[model samples]
Target: MEPIYKISTKKIRLLLAAVVIPCLIISITRLYYCDKVEYVRPLALEGEMQLRNDRFGDGHYAARRAGGKRHAGVDILADLDTPVIAIRGGRARALIDEDGFGNYIIITHWDETKSLYGHLSRVLLPPLGFVRQGDVIGEVGKTGNANYKSMKAHMHFEIRRKGKTIDPTFIMEAENIKK
Candidate 1:
């Protein structure tokens, strides 16, 4: 007698198709979710927060005045000489040692959001270049027009979307804020 054929060709085909189809579907779903959800962390680690003020002490706060005056940026005050990291995976769109921002590093993120780290003591090499998420962008210092008296040596962080300034607090979801 001929050796009996154990499994049918149709069953084998079905088994292979079932396993392959689910994997393909899962991969597509994962990609979609990953693209949609962009996570960013605070530029600075846990530290002391200082009072917010305009560089010139003009009574108007940096964030509030920026909105109406078309300035668009937020200022977070952390310790001086603190390390500033990239919030998300993105390219260094621009690095400017301007009058007000000091040694500033601007990162253009995946979601078209730009995160600004200012008042840096020293910026890393390849100044205007690409960097991975969590890369050290610069060291926090009272550069630019930072009011060291009131703000101290702190990282002035800002987030801009569509070339307009929005509240950085809205985007930051880090639960590391100290009391």
Candidate 2:
């Protein structure tokens, strides 16, 4: 009996290449975007902290400012004075009140990565002070651009690598740390 169809070696190789190449490319892309790093929740409290705004492409990050500047971080809706902590061990690079970030603290991690905690009601650590992971750093509030009568209090958080903004959700999720 003759087979109705016979697959040639070249055809088999081409079939495998079509499937394998795309899979490899997809895996590499996923790894680049979803790579995990050592990080913890900035807030120690349990339960789901509603996202007021997410990183770029959603929420304030997508909205342009007066000069067409987009929001640079995620905003986690929380009550006024909610405790904020360091996502990793780092030094408090700057702690100040500004027109945009309000009261914010920039923590420079050992890897040169930085985390910004903004819209804070209070800054606990002094500039250049070291902070341990999970240590209390500040309390959330509607400071800076968040100070609107209709705007609920929240924490605007940002993760930066070499001064470039990266999604904080990716870092938090990679560590399985809930926001």
Candidate 3:
């Protein structure tokens, strides 16, 4: 007999299909979830009162003399001591007590946008250097120098874009939640 030669075309095609199929699936799934922003509104008052703020009406900014004071946050209405939760998956960047915002927690999301939960009555620290989505950052209260009491005790939620405050309402819409 001469030299025996065999090539399995079926085997080659099967190998290619197996590799290609999984690659396609992974690519599609990645595009679906990559850097997509997710959020949950601050706790409602017994699920009755909706979130609001007198400082800036929904989709509007408070005017300032320095320039147009674009409202950079969405206010979430909660009881005087309701817990404020993270709206997206990320780590805690900073939690600061200040004059205007009072005690606040800054949570960073995958998209690089930072969610600021402010005017909190109290904040629970995560080992002083750790936090995650759905973590309770603080309790709502009127602590800031701002007139939080007259406005109602709630979480002042702000989403910063490139370090600038834009209407957080736009972000809520992008995340597809009704204001």
* Model number with the top TM-score: 2
**Number of colliding residue pairs in each model:** 3, 0, 0
> What tens digits encode model 2's per-residue C-alpha lDDT throughout 82-128?
89988877667555666778989888766678899998998898444
Cα lDDT tens digits, model 3, 1-179, are: 76597658998897788677632222322221122235554443343335564654442334342254555665666778887767665556545566667888787555667778788888875664345545577788876744434677667777776897666655444544322
Best by lDDT: 2
TM-score for model 2?
A: 0.69
After TM-score superposition, the amount by which residue 116's alpha carbon in candidate 2 deviates from its true location, in angstroms, is: 0.1
> Worst ten-residue run, lDDT, model 2?
28-37
Point out the worst 10-residue segment of candidate 3 by lDDT.
Answer: 25-34
Question: What lDDT score belongs to each candidate, Candidate 1 first?
Answer: 0.61, 0.72, 0.60
Deviation (Å) of 18 in candidate 1: 21
lDDT for each residue of candidate 1 in 24-71, tens digit (9 for 90 to 100): 222321211112224445455554344345564432124334346633
What TM-score would candidate 1 get against the native? 0.61
